[model samples]
Target: MKRLTAAAGSNLPVGPYSQAVISGNLVFTAGQIPVIPGQHIQPETFEQQVRQTLRNLETVLQAAGSDFDHVVKVNGYLTDPAQLEPYNRVYAEMLGHAPPARTTVCVSLWGVALEIECIAEVIDHRLRV
Candidate 1:
């Protein structure tokens, strides 16, 4: 069975999609943008947006009974390729050793600077009945 999961305190979905969905041991998260709830604003700097996006991703993973440590793959989109260095710096710092396989690309985004999505392995103990 598949289950939809939403992170507590996270912003409501930007569209008709759940923050994450769990199927068996795998958790798939929808692309996370840097919009913070209540504020309705994305951070000013590219680095700040990257960090907020990662933090938002963390919330989705936790809601799915997983975390960055268990992420198996990551997909990131940046509006400009020039932002890659700063994005990498924050990503490396947050993921630390043994970071998951990642694919990042430059794409035109609407309003936001970047977006991030990931796949993670849900711990067996966290399976819901």
Candidate 2:
């Protein structure tokens, strides 16, 4: 097992935890919030927050040798049920078609609209040649 820190300029973990972990062929990412790396401000809109969160997730995934196409599971948390529609739209737009199995629920978050985490299969780029 290997632990990863902030990847591809993604935000550093707020607590004592790695951003992602790799074991064998799989990469497990910690939940990502909408805060931009090196910036404390978060996007004001739910849709914008969702997009930023996915961008952070993508950064960690790519660093772990994976991408959205390789994701197999996702767990999402939203502070409001009303944000679901916009969240879905942004999710589809960012994660692409045929998204992985996911579970999203309304929950209380500290000054954030949503959070997302994913499990993905790691790709060995050398094999592509």
Candidates in order have lDDT scores of 0.86, 0.88
Q: lDDT per residue, candidate 2, 46-115, as tens digits?
A: 7888999999899999888899999999999999888999998999897758789999999999888899
Candidate 1 regions with alpha-carbon error over 4 angstroms: none
How badly does each model clash, as a count of residue pairs?
A: 0, 0
Task: Identify the candidate with maximal lDDT.
Answer: 2
Worst 10-residue lDDT window, candidate 2: 120-129
lDDT of 2 at 29: 94
| Model 2 pairs in collision | none
Model 2 gets an lDDT of: 0.88
